[model samples]
Target: MKKLILPILLTICVIAISCQQKEKQNSIPKMVNSDGSYETVPLEKDTLVLKLIQNSVRNVKKIENAKEVVNENLQKVKNLVVEACTTGDKPNIVLMHEFPLTGYLYGGRKDKVQMALQIPGEETSELCALAKQYDTYIIFGSYAIDPEWPDHILSLTTVIGRDGEILKKIWKPRNIKRFYSSFEITTTTVESVREKFIEKYGIEEELPVLRTEYGNIALSTVQLDPFIFSAFTMKGAEIILRTSTLFFESDIIYTAMANNVYSAMANIPADSPYGGNSMVVAPSGKVMARLDKTTEGVLEAKIPIAKFRENRKLPQYAIELTKDIFKQYQEEIPANHLDMPKEKLPQNGKEMKVLLDSLSTWLNQ
Candidate 1:
């Protein structure tokens, strides 16, 4: 009777321990949303880790050497990807600065045409191979020669998926023209610009968002306009990647906080006057990781998608500003100011300044 009783007690202890362990494993943290609804905290699968490489831009004068430069930069990027992967968990996405492979062209049409490579051409093929090798989505910028217009070049941001497929290509809308003596400035009218985008991409919108497994990502170039950021957030963008030749600025941080989305900027290593300081900002506007201004390095961060969504639900200044004003002026404000008619715009820089001054005076009144 004593032996049977001891065995029964041991069995009960074993069953109790098993139940406790199962409960612990199944339990998850919970948080209350602003709407008074409860939700389980997101697990590892709900987060996206990203690595943004701030590579040095090597300017190659000869078009023939472009492949070599691309190969060299790719090697550096691959090494960084490997390094990031080896450290604990691997990154879901890898991003490179503008012109990471093919350096940005500052010369005339001849130079641009010489430097521009075809989309899905040799460079992107190699990049796609790397993306498949790492099993990570990669985003990189380059100057691409428009197949339809051999004489023209477009600044392109190419996104390669984990399966080695080219997912999307975004052309830079706001192109900066430098009045250099050596290069001829093509006077592009507002109507021509609108026609060019509609003819090429079939979309009138300047900022286009790409829906992905990780989050809704939007790509942009050097120009960091608050309105553009707001537009993306309004359209349900969760992550904003700005590939630029310019340095990371405070605007990126502010945009992240205002929109309650993860914002990242990848820039060259001070090779040009505008390039330097790559950075990543959290949904709360905190700097997660940053590469030094002069160094060629990678910035990695884990973005909590669930938490970011929750942050978006919180009251934000940008959202407040749009409460009544946005709907009222939605039709009045042009999507792209450059798309506006020339007759409504100031004729010259002087006239533009005068008009701005007059508006400022009226606003002050």
Candidate 2:
């Protein structure tokens, strides 16, 4: 799940409670916009947890050659995520890991080339175990090597139901190397992965025209950008919801006549070079969830457009929350003082703490 970026204007005609009552709103969502889009509603408990996990692991590793650092960081995150998943021993689990390796073209150098270059065997196994233990399904993103083709490739592994059972996978084209990959994951016993793939990737056969509340969304065969997951456009609602194995890409965007969500997050290295995760985006973008391999590994939260719409102040409000969290991380562990070289380290644990705390507060906010 990518972070909420930009302010989504909701025109719900409802008064909102002050931030003090945000706790009560946890079960019930506040109205941020006054366009009558949605009534003040409360998110289910599971929905909130999913949002928290999304933001927890923003930037996994930042080191250049710190393979060991990357490996350790990934494990720590996995443990934390696993713990969260089994908190109440929830029966059915849907885990999505959106690793955006080739999304950002910074200075002509892809940010996630490290993870894209090679598939870390250990990391793959770890994720597989998590899926098995929780009976979870994952939308894993990374660079993959073509077993039959003659090239290195970036791919999203559609691994599901544990024990190295591959359900379905999609690959993307980036220069000579294939960059993006996505697909649906089902049980190994699933007789027809292709059928599920058609259902997810090819939703058109089922619904020729889909209607949404906003206006109109257009569902096309076109996979979303970066990684072409599955794209559905509700032309009636003017919203496009895309599902990518990679998080940063706009798998889901509510596009009205005015603004759209660049709802993209960064990719976590299978072997993170730093001690934790780090996610980078334009100041306007937001991170929605963080999924790791551990039991307590996942965290999720969302900036409901309704919460801050009373005075057209929700976007800035979310920005303040993100900035304050970053500031807190700097206070806890000065980035300059980390053990690893400056370039190789992701934001320190202290920064992650700030992100986590901020998410917790946002839920209450």
User: Which prediction has the highest lDDT against the true structure?
Assistant: 1
| lDDT of candidate 2 over 132-225, digit per residue (tens) | 7765444345444443322222344343443434444533311111122321121011111224433345523322222322122222112323
**lDDT of model number 2:** 0.33
RMSD of 1: 20.5
lDDT of 1 by residue, 9-46 (tens): 99999999999988965652222234622223333367
Q: Residue 10's C-alpha lDDT in candidate 2?
A: 28
Each candidate's number of clashing pairs is 0, 89
| TM-score, predicted candidate 2 vs. hidden true structure | 0.35
- Report the alpha-carbon TM-score of model 1 versus the true structure: 0.69
Clashes of 2: 89
- Residue pairs with colliding backbones in model 1 are none
Which structure among the candidates has the greatest TM-score?
1
**Estimated TM-score for each candidate:** 0.69, 0.35
